[model samples]
Target: MPPSDLDLLLRLRLVVARVGESDNANWWASDGVLSPTGQYAYDRIAPRTGPFARARVAFAVAQERCASQVPPGALTLWTLPADTEEAFDDRWSHWLDHVEDWAPTFAAVEAINTSSILTALVEHGLIDGQHADAARALTAAPPDPSVRLAETAHIDVDAVRQLAAGFACSQPAALVVPYVRSNA
Candidate 1:
C-alpha cells in the first residue's frame, strides 16, 4: 500500500529539521538569507563528497516537499542546556513536556528526539559510565508511530536551486516588499 499524504508531510518535516540543524548554511537560510531548502542550498555554495548519498536524497525530497507545501518562517533550533544543573534540569523538563505532546501524534519523531537527547547526555559527560548505562537500559519504547516511511519521488534539483537563489535576495534594513538582492 502507498503512504498517505500526511505521512509524506511528517517525514518531510523531520528531514528538513535534521538537515537544517546540521548545516550552518541552512541556519542562515532559515534566517531568510536563502531558501529553506536547508542542506540543498548549502551544497549549492559548497559541494562536498560523502557516503551520505542516501541521506542527501532524503533531505532533497524533504526540501522539495516543504517548498511545495510548508511556508517558510523563522528558524528554530533544539539545544541541550549548559552543564549547570539548573539549566540541565530546566531543559530536560521542557523537552520531556514537548515529547509527551509530540508522542501522541509524532511518535517516530519523539523517539528520534529522545534517542538524540540521551546520546547527547552521554557524549557531553553529563551522565557517565554506570549512570549512562543505566539511563540507556531504562529507556522506554517509543509509542506507536502515527506515520510510517515510504519511497518518495525525486525532486528537481535545479528548480530548487533556482528558488533558493531567489530567496537569497534581500532588501535594505528598513525596506519592505521590493528586495535589493544582496551581493552574496
Candidate 2:
C-alpha cells in the first residue's frame, strides 16, 4: 500500500518547520544584540523570568532537536506545572500555557512562515548564500526535482538559484479577512 497525499504533505511541512526553527534559534543565539534572552517581540507577551534563564531553555530545546537531525525526544517533558498531574492538558500548547501564557506558537502555521524566513536568512547572509542547494535538498521543485537534484544540486547551483523563489512571491501573508456573522 502507498501513503496518502496528506502524509506526503505533512512530511514536507515537518521538514520546513525543523529547518526554520533551527535557523531562528541560531539567529537568536548570536545576534550580538540580545541581552541573553531578551527578544523584543515577546516583551509585550510576558515579563522576563530573571533574564536569559527562560529564553536559554527554549532555544536549547529547539537547537537540540536540530542537532539530532530529528524532532527532540521526550517533548512530553514540556508539561504543565503545579507539581501535580491533573493541572495539565495532554497537548503541546496546553503544556506551554502552563510554562508561559504566551506560548510562542509554531505549530503547522510554521509551514507557511518558513519560506519567507529562509529567504530572509539568505538575504541577510546568516546562512551561506548557497541557498539554492539547501532549498533543493529540502524541496522537490518543478521541472523534475529528482533530475534537477542530479544535474545541478551540487555545482555552483546557479540554475536552481531561484530556489523557493516562487513561494515568497506566491504565498500571501497570513491575513485575517473579516467576516460578518449575521445578527438577525
Candidate whose TM-score is highest = 2
Q: How would you encode candidate 1's per-residue C-alpha lDDT over 8-57 as one tens digit per residue?
A: 32333343333233232232122311223423555466444211222334
Q: For model 2, what is the error of residue 16's alpha carbon versus the real structure, in angstroms, after optimal superposition?
A: 11
Model 2 C-alpha lDDT per residue in residues 57-132, reported as the tens digit of each score: 4434533432332122211111112221132222323334444432332222222234354554354333355643
Q: Residue pairs in steric clash, candidate 1?
A: none
Q: Candidate 1 — which residues are off by over 4 angstroms?
A: 1-3, 21-28, 31-101, 104-184
Tell me which residue pairs clash in candidate 2.
Answer: none
Give the TM-score of each candidate: 0.19, 0.25
Best candidate, lDDT: 2
- Candidate 1 lDDT at 113 equals 25
What local lDDT score does residue 94 receive in model 1, on the 0 to 100 scale?
Answer: 42
| Model 1 lowest lDDT segment of ten | 173-182
Global local distance difference test of model 1: 0.28
Cα-lDDT of candidate 2 = 0.29
